[model samples]
Target: MAMHMAMEVDQADDPRLQAYTSIREKDLTSGHGARFIIEGKVTLETALRRGRFKLESLFLAASRLEPLADLLAEVPADVPVYVAPQDVMDTVVGFPMHRGVLACGIKGEIPFPANFLDADAKTGGPSTLLMLSGLSNHDNVGACFRNAAAFGADAVLMDGQCCDPLYRKAIRVSSGASLWLPYAHGGTGADMVHAAQAAGYEVWAMTPRAKAQTLGTLRVPEKLAILLGAEGPGLPDDLIAAATPVRIPMSSGFDSVNVATAGAITLAHVFGARESP
Candidate 1:
């Protein structure tokens, strides 16, 4: 591969490098439609290779650039790749410089839930989707996406209340699966269930309620949407009432599991069941 040169940043405040400055604060204040940061070598590589989001710029610790030459070569020439000394990068990002890799990319428009579901139908195969409601923890959101990808879920649908899966921490935790997987954020939990039903999916609400069907015994459908909610609240009563509630059976004492864990178990079961005769 031909060598590509990245612009060097001697000063942290260069106007062209503003997106990498004080990243945490910028991420919080910046609206969802704006550019978001990607951190770590793996995450950066996935974003560049996936080509889902448009790359805006890359900021790397000057010392790490040589080791990342091949990956940097994959970047488009027109996109700015900025290399800064370790101390300067620390100053710009307002954090201790460690992993030494970061990139910024514009947020692409998310497809509507109905459109995403319809597109899966057009594929003419079994479909699985994960729907999240009021899941505020970035870690859980990211882990859920990772699990979705692992268990063959076609897409993830998040209600407006769920944390952004693109949040830097979430993206990192997901090992960049958030970028690779298709997702949409909008509407109420009830709306998501209804949309899945309209798309011919058997919407299964995951909860620990006594009335819920045990996951081990329930028959999985060809097209299934598994609904999960925040850790403590689980699914709303109305949302639970709207769909068939399913639970992971446990020993007598344990009543619940983390939402992401529950999602993984449920997804694995459903995906496996769909494969059986």
Candidate 2:
């Protein structure tokens, strides 16, 4: 192909690079202006391949330009791709980092939580959802999204209590699954459950309580919503009381499965177990 088209940025304060400045601090807020940061080569590539979010721009370390030529060439000519020496990138990021790729994405219009619950209806087939609540850790949120996508869940519904899945760290941890996964954050756990149920999903709130139905014993449903809570506090008592409770049977006295892991096992049962002879 023809030579890669890119601009060389020598100063950290260049006007075009404003969106990438002090990204960590910007992450502290709601990715202000409905924007999010995509870091590392994998996530950047995922965003490009999925076309789920509009990329505002790309800032890469000088070394990455050649290695990512093919990927960069695919970038729309309208989007600015800026390359800078490692030192300038470090200054702009305000941190010690090893990976050399960064991207800014516009989240565009946020979707209604209830509307997203029905996005899969047009397919005329089974649909699955992964719901989360009170999960403050970005890593857990990301892992859950990764698992949900891996298991072919149609979407994710995270209550207001959960952290932003688009956070840069979460995006990297999820390998950019969140970029393509249909998710609606910022609703109460109750709101999520009601919406899923209204969409004809069998809502199962996952918990460690022994009285709940064990995952191995339950018959998975065609349209299902698996609800998981934060690490320390599983599902709230009232929430668990509201839905059919499901549990992953564990060895004696060992009920502490990471929320994300529990999600994977239950999802596997839904997507993988039935096919087994």
Candidate 3:
């Protein structure tokens, strides 16, 4: 058992504590461990009161915190409660986390794409899928998954260029959707596109280039997978030309929408069509 230190606020914002904060925050959804949170509190009493977050430990300012007899009784005898001065806590965390309550929990695992497909295979097959290509931004990847889940896509597949869906920032940015939605990371975009087509899907590449067919007019098939590229450079020309291009109609002058936003709209369209026919 690590020796628990309970002191005053003198050490708040210490560099050591800040590093721990960053690690704990980033490790929440990582498979290495579980969900961990640091709750800031003005005093130990306040820290004890906000028990809903399931605090694993309490860090407080020794000088400012007034030891609560009742709260101490409730905590496990072995749980170490550390108290430091307000400044100490601030110094440790790199900022003023006056609340002084921090806890870590084990985050649940996200389901594999194969498992999701196995379960859903019997139900009219998957109608909509999101195929990501070279999306590096963790926030964007998570956002895309969140959109896919919201818009009724059946699965999300990540290519080699995409970030890990289980990343900590991705998990939170996805509002925990990362854990709930079925996702897989494998294969090149072209390889997955070929596989999807082989599986009876009409692969549609979402792009802004004018040569592509308008999204509204495409004869959407029963099963569809929307392929999206990263920001800036857009989908590789080869992939775009190889896929049946589907362009979302925006104001004639506007360029394009955010990749995730466009993905949501495209998914809604595909699922909407599935509903009609």
Best by the lDDT measure: 1
| Tens-place lDDT digits, model 2, residues 1-277 | 1245688999999998887888888763364368888999889889998859888899999998888888887787778888999999999998854798999988876555676765545446677889998999999999999999998888888888999888998988888999998888877888878887888889899998989998878777878889999998888988898799988889997886888999999988888854555
Q: Which of the two, 1 or 3, has more lDDT?
A: 1
| C-alpha TM-scores of all predictions | 0.95, 0.94, 0.64
lDDT agreement with native, every candidate: 0.86, 0.85, 0.65
Winner on lDDT between 1 and 2 is 1
Off by over 4 Å in 1: 1-4, 28-33, 118-120
Q: Candidate 3 residues 1-277, lDDT tens each?
A: 2233343334435432432354433545444545544343222333244322233555545643454434555555545566666555555655665444443333444434444444555346558889889898988898998888788887787776787765645655665555556677655777767766766678899999888899889787778888999987779988887789888888979969999888988888777777784
Q: Which residue window of length 10 is worst by lDDT in model 1? A: 24-33
Q: What's the lDDT for candidate 1?
A: 0.86
What lDDT is obtained when candidate 2 is compared to the true structure?
0.85
Poorest stretch of ten by lDDT in candidate 3: 38-47
Question: How displaced is residue 15 in candidate 3, in Å?
Answer: 16
lDDT tens digits, residues 1-277, model 1? 2335678889988998888889877763136657888999999999989848888888989898889998888998778888889999999999986999998988867766766666656445788889999999999999999999999898899998888888899999888999889898877888888889998888999999888888888777777899998989889999999999988898898989999999999988887787778
Error of 1 at 218 (Å): 1.4
